[model samples]
Target: MENHEDVDIVIVGAGLAGLTTALALHRLGLRSLVLESSESLRTTGFALTIWTNAWRALDAVGIGDSLRLKSTQMKGFKIASPDTGLFTSEQALDKDGKFKGYESRCVRRKDLLEALVDELPPSTVRYSSKVANIEELDRFKLVHLADGSILKAKVLIGCDGVKSVVAKWLGLGAPVRVGRSAIRGLVEFPNGSGLDPMFHVNFGGGVRFGFVPVDEKSVYWFFTFTPSQVPSYEEDWKENPMKMKQFILSRINKMPQHAQDVVEKTSLSSISIAPLKFRLPWNILFGNIVKDNVTVAGDALHPMTPDIGQGGCSSLEDSVVLGRCLGEAFLNKSNEEDDEFERIKKGLEKYGKERRWRSFSLISVAYCVGFIQESKGILMTYFRKAWFSSYTPSAFLKMANYDCGNLVS
Candidate 1:
């Protein structure tokens, strides 16, 4: 008993990218189907930092105001180190940089996903739908789902994430592991966290840990470090939050007591840990990110380390750009399969070209930043103590200053 469907467009993975893509298309009077392998909406990551660029994208898709209402805007940041007793002065975020009115917020992943989902029409997302295999045809692509269902799509967009199946189908290759792991959590102070709306960071003991207030009562924090050896109980730790909590506390003892307090206060179920991975800039520059009527976005297209806090922000940008490109093609399409194919191919080509360099730059910057901040050596120490202390803030803020343009444009 196989169910069959013929869709104008099929988007895999109902993540920030996929849902935003669908919403952008919906805004342009277009329709798309989003297939999620999970039984329901998945909000795995506790939260993410959305910068000025991401807010612009969110505004384009009509969810910016709602998200802004739920989160607090970050004002500035302070960097310090416990090992070397190096403390950098707090710096205010530049408001008149490349993009004026600098803004950033640590938004709950659930809120961001729900905001996008709310804008989309009901039944637009089909859950429990996993893409098993794909086959390219003369005019359409056949998408095989694990549940004995087949989707014939005129265009296919994959937002399936780091271990993307569609990326593999597009010959984009696998993401490279960065020899580091990150543990992130969101903890609430029922009364109040009494923390200012700013970014707080500490780098030492082969680790880089940071925290920011998502709101007055909730704070999001992350600790990243290179693993010396595989923990035999890694799987057990993931399942048991207490184990994860103990593990993080043990490694980040040098962090501020308040920072340590946040971790201690975090509920068992609010923590998660995973190894970081990224696609090489060279691979993205030369890979087949876009092929004919098929393409990828978000982590699927350019999975990068979380050092720059642009992984989610960049994914939001991807959705808006891809949506605009595809919308332009569909709006002017003729009523013929061959013409439609050419139009889609051209639109995707436009998307791939637009994102290739941007993706490469982001991956490279995130990798380099992580390396410089986390590596331990006399030369690296000097660079961090001197160069990074003065120039890091400006450099980090500059990356968040991109504008991906509006959907209507």
Candidate 2:
């Protein structure tokens, strides 16, 4: 095997998690290489709702302002009943005149990724370098790429998605599916649809629908439910947009006219389906997050549902915190303590210890919220709406405004 000198860090996967970590490290005066499987980034997919905590993390990494320009601040949200076809309740996220203090914004996922990638130095990210295997060398970690090249570093950070090669190589295994599927797509409304800037949640039997304005002229929407015996693959489903639309229409046929109209306007070419899965809680903090100078972050560590929209945010938080921890460790290592390996190990351990609990809590809460939203039966539906209306918008805002930094002691 060809050998390479060790660098500060090796980050695998160039998505939000990897890019965010790279930016954080740069801010901390450290340098790292980002290996991306794809050759180029594309502006695809729908928008994501980023809560205050995510915004804070973004600011910590110094890309918040640039991202803000590409996003729309969400002012409020509403929940409608599918059975009754009536608006159950509406809550302005900033209703208490606290919009300036705790604000949430939604942006196109692709846009966020592009902005993050732009912040990193050109040579910092290695595109088309698909990682095939990760081996633990005696003194450093080795990352094997598909192009018959190898790179060595003191620490390996895996920001790969749900099926992380780093995690698998480290014996973490694949994430088990949590028995749900999500159908999502970005829809463009013709000028003057009169869509509000608030998020809309439509709840019915065994399924839930959500729509959020991506910008003044477009809306991103999705539907989630327990997967049926028959799987919904992206290929087969897109072949028949009308069939899928009919499925959605049948479920929400009793809903309000506006809700029905949105579904009708959706095109098959724009929609995609993905299975909704949650990683096991124990698995998140299990295994050696740092083994032989190799570690993992983001969805590779704590993959969760989109209920709270914190999956990407939590990943960003991990990147920032991990960078800070490593940066501090590198600076503190004196000549007398010339053990770079020991220092990096300590830093990885600190990163895992500081991040595990809070990330797990967010995952658990998001799972429960998803369950409530996907509840079936008449009684549960009534209780769900009742529970939503009982809580003041301020209370929800407080929950949404939870800062990971405060919880990271």
The lDDT of each candidate is: 0.87, 0.75
lDDT of 1 by residue, 1-409 (tens): 2456889999999998999999999999999999999999998899999998999999998899999999999988777764633345687765434434888999999999998888889989999999999987667899999987899999999999998989999898799899999988899999999987888887755788889999999999998988773365577775666876787788667656777899999987788788899998898999999999999999999999998899999999999999999997889756566576788899999999999999999999999988888888888888887778656667677888899999867
- Please list the Cα RMSD from the true structure of every candidate, rounded to 1 decimal place: 2.4, 2.9
Best by lDDT: 1
CA error at residue 85 for candidate 1, angstroms: 6.2
What does the lDDT come to for candidate 1?
Answer: 0.87
Off by over 4 Å in 2: 1-6, 97-100, 190-192, 229-238, 334-338, 388-399, 404-409
Q: Write the per-residue lDDT of candidate 2 for residues 1-409, one digit (tens) a residue.
A: 6756566688988878899889988877789998888887645566677778788888887778988886677888777766576767777756556555777777888888888878888888888999887777778777888888888877788998888888777777577777778878777777744677787877556787878777776678888877672465445556766777777777777767777777778777777778877777776666566665677889887788877677877887888788887886677767555587777778888888888777777778778777777777778778776774334344446546755451122
Error of 1 at 243 (Å): 4.9
Off-target runs (Cα >4 Å) in candidate 1 are 1-3, 84-87, 94-100, 229-243, 333-338
Q: TM-score for all predictions?
A: 0.94, 0.91
